[model samples]
Target: MQYVRLGKTGLNVSPVAFGGIPIQRGTAEDTKAIVDKMEELGMNYIDTARGYTVSEEYLGAALQGRRERFILATKSMVRDCSGMKKEVDVSLEKLRTDYIDLYQIHNIKTADFEQVFGEEGAYKALLEARHEGKIGHIGITAHSIDDLKTILSEHADQIETIMFPFNLVEIQGEAALKEAKAKDIGTIAMKPLAGGNLEDWRLALRFVALSGTCDISIPGMGDVEEVEKNASVCCDLSPLTEEERTEIERLRKELGNQFCRRCGYCAPCTVGIDIPTNFVFANYLRKYGLADWAKDRYASLKVNASDCIQCGVCEERCPYDLPIMDMLKKVEEDFAR
Candidate 1:
């Protein structure tokens, strides 16, 4: 497998890192088999989060005796120092590990770093924990490339890694990746396959790897076949040919303009609806076989598409300029049945 240096951490991670989300859907034995296959293929970096239910526990059980063979990275969404410390301790116990290779502030979106890095914020707790030998490196994951750039510039001394969404559809991180490389901060690419919307895994994986900015890609692989296919792509670092690129372009065009990028730029709905989340559940209902669960979750939303007041405010703010009212209407019509 192709090994790349994980920025300032100085850790050599396989280009294809194992993502622990999909494993939560499988049986323990199934999860164990997938982990074993990844280990056998020399894919060492494992990324999970406390947000992903049962993922850490299953990975902990799978890697029980082979913990030393992999680099474990997990995240927490807690914003306070005490809560952050508690979450880390819980994660350690669940993972059956004494220390995590990387502990990250998960899904950082708001400009709360001033509060986060302040004396009472979680950053101080992370420093104390690291000094006490609980975490080896500190990192942050964000959906916005701009936020990551800002964080890197402000806290370059404390931040060892940065995780951002990098996929075939959204090549938004080219500049951020360059900056991370220049600063020697490890770059982790999430959604490498465009949240499984892109069907061509080979082309998608190759494109990200060839960018030279991606140190490791943590694609969610729930089965052994997926693990092998992903590992094979890393094992052979082949770039996509012109013909393949043309085909991908054609597919993108054919898929048309209905896909939601989940950027959430059109947010703070007047009716208090979560626009991106509604679209996410809608996509899962259509693409995957979680229709029942999606419907239940959709029903539980405080303000779903059905509650949209057709204000046109969200559409005006959308960078993609998507027809928010029309899409929400469709979601209401389709999922509310």
Candidate 2:
């Protein structure tokens, strides 16, 4: 496995980090098998979030006697000092470890830094926790460049790493990754497969590995074949052929502007609809061949696409300027049928 220095944290991590989201869908035995394979392949960085259900717990259980063999990172979404402190304690307990290699503020949006770093903010708790030996390093994650820049500028002293969605389709992260590198903050690229929208695994993995900014790209691996394939890509940093590059470009063009990257920028909707989540379910139905599953999941949402009130508020906030209301209407109609 190829190892890269993770910015100021000084941790040399493998190019292929283990993303914990997909493990939530697997049984404990399956998760253990995948993780054991990852470790065997020398992929040492494991990232999970408190919001990813039992992912951290399962990883903790899997790594019980082998904690020193890997770099474990987890995150919490708490914005207050007390809540942040409490969450970190719970995470430490769940992970069966006293010190986390990296602890992060999860899915930070535009207003998150100001909210978490301000007076009486969560950074106070994080700093205290760090000093108390609960976590070794601090990190922040976001889906937008704007939020990333804001965090870097405002809390550069406190942040040792940052995570963001980076894939062949969203090349916009390149600049942000460069900036983070310059600031000596480790950059972890999430959604390296475009949330499984990219059909060709080789092209997707090669694109991310060649990006030059990603110290580690964490693709959600759920099965043994996936682990082997990802490990193979990491072990051999081979570039894509001309024909493969052309095919990737064609696929990107076909996906077009309507593809929701799920940045969650169009949030706090006036009508209370979960815009990003609705789009996720729509994509699962259209691309992932989980139409029935997506429909059932969408129907369970308290505020679904069906609740969209035709307001253009979400569109105005979207950086991509997606016609969210129309899309939601289409989702409601398509899934209902």
Candidate 3:
């Protein structure tokens, strides 16, 4: 596997890190098998979060004797020093490690920065942890361009790494990511596959790696085959050919700007709508040419898009500022036909 220096952190890491979100869908044994494959290929970097249910615990169990082989990274949503300090201890305990290579402020926004970087904010706690040898570096993850812009411009000296969504279609973060890279802050492409919207995983990953903006891309992997596929791409880093470049344009035009990234920030829908799932099925029906399967899946949902009461609650939480009510209305209309 190919390795790159993770910005100022000075940690040599795999170009394609192992994203730990998908493991929650599997069993402990399944996680072990997945981690076993990652170890076999020397993937060497694992990114998980406190919010990803059971991901930290399962990864901790799987890392067992091999914890030192990989650079472990995780994030939390708390914004205060006390809360973040407690979270660091919890993450260490859950990850079954004495030291974490990277600890991040998860999904930070422009409005939360004042409090987060305050005298008694999460940043203080992370600095304290790094000083005490509990964490090696500090990073931030965000879905907003404004937030990334702020970090790269004014707060670049404060953060060692910055993660944001980057894919063939979602190149909105391109300029900011480039700026971050220029500043020597590790730039990680979070939704490298456009939240599973892109079918050509090889092209999707290659686009980000060759883009010159991002240092690494973390595509969520649940199985050994996925690890093998993503690792193979990293090992054989090549420029996109003319045909692939043309295909990239086609995908960008086809997906447009309104599609969901499946970040799941728009949760606890007032009416219990599985918002991302609805969008996924809709995409399958419209884009994947799987109308019957998509219809079946939508039918199985207890509350589909058509059931949306248009309460506007989800739109408030969506970091991308997508018009959720209107998008769901379109999904409802498409599935009705």
Candidate 4:
């Protein structure tokens, strides 16, 4: 597989890395099989999170004696120093490792900036962990373009990497990602397949590889076949063929309006719903054939799509101007059936 330096951290990683979200649908053995394939293909970066249910634990088990074989990265949502300090240890324990390669402030929003970067904030915990040899570097993940832009422009000095949604349809982060690369902050592309909305895996992977906006693209992988397919593309960093470029424009027109990029601009749901999360669960049910898994996850949510009262507050905030109320209705219907 082809490898690249992860910005200021200077860690060399595969251009196509492993995303841990889909591991929630698989067993420990399944994770090991996938990891074994990754090792065989020389794909060395594995990203998981404390929020992805059993992802970190399963990966820890999968790594076993081979933890050194990969550059392990994971994230947490805790915002305060004390909580982040404890969560880092919990992540270490769950991953069965004394040290984590990279620990990220997970899914930061615009409103979270002050608190996260302030005194007694999670950033302090990460800095301490780095000093204490618990983590090698710090990164941040965001779903909003504006939030990522802010980090790239202002917080660039503090973070080594930034991950945001970048794919065939979600070019909204294009400029921000370019700025990130310019600032030497590693750019990671999440949801390369548009959260499974894009059916063409080869095209999706190729698009991100050729985009030049990201150092790596981590599409969620559950099994060995996926590992092989994603790994194959990394070897040849070729530009898109004429035919491929045409196909991309076609895809852009086809999916531009209806797809939810999960930017989270439409937040603060009037009824206290997690809008992007509801769409995510519904997408898993529709695309991953993980109906039972998706339903169980949706069940755990404090509020589901069914909770949306169609007040249209979320619609007003959406940059895409998605008919969120109508979309939530579909998600509710999908889960209800």
By summed lDDT, which 10 consecutive residues of candidate 2 come out lowest? 256-265
Q: Alpha-carbon error at 88 in model 2, in Å?
A: 0.9
- Clash pairs, model 1 backbone: none
How much is 327 displaced in model 2, in angstroms?
A: 1.3
For every model shown, what is its TM-score relative to the native structure?
0.82, 0.84, 0.98, 0.84
- Residue-level lDDT of model 2, residues 122-178, one tens digit each, is 888888999998888889888767877777677777899989878888777788788
Index of the highest-TM-score prediction? 3
lDDT of candidates 1 onward, in order: 0.84, 0.84, 0.92, 0.90
So what's the TM-score on candidate 1? Answer: 0.82
Query: Where does candidate 2 stray beyond 4 Å?
Result: 261-323, 332-337
- Our tally of clashes for model 4 stands at 0
Error of 4 at 238 (Å): 1.6
Stretches off by above 4 angstroms in model 3 are: none
* Global Cα RMSD, each model: 5.1, 4.0, 0.9, 5.1
Candidate with maximal lDDT: 3
Model 3 — TM-score against the truth?
0.98
Cand. 2 Cα-lDDT: 0.84
- Candidate order by lDDT, decreasing, is 3, 4, 1, 2
Task: Give candidate 1 misplaced runs (Cα > 4 Å).
Answer: 251-258, 261-326, 331-337
Q: Counting only residues 3 or more apart in sequence or on different chains, how many pairs clash (N, Cα, C under 3 Å) in candidate 1?
A: 0
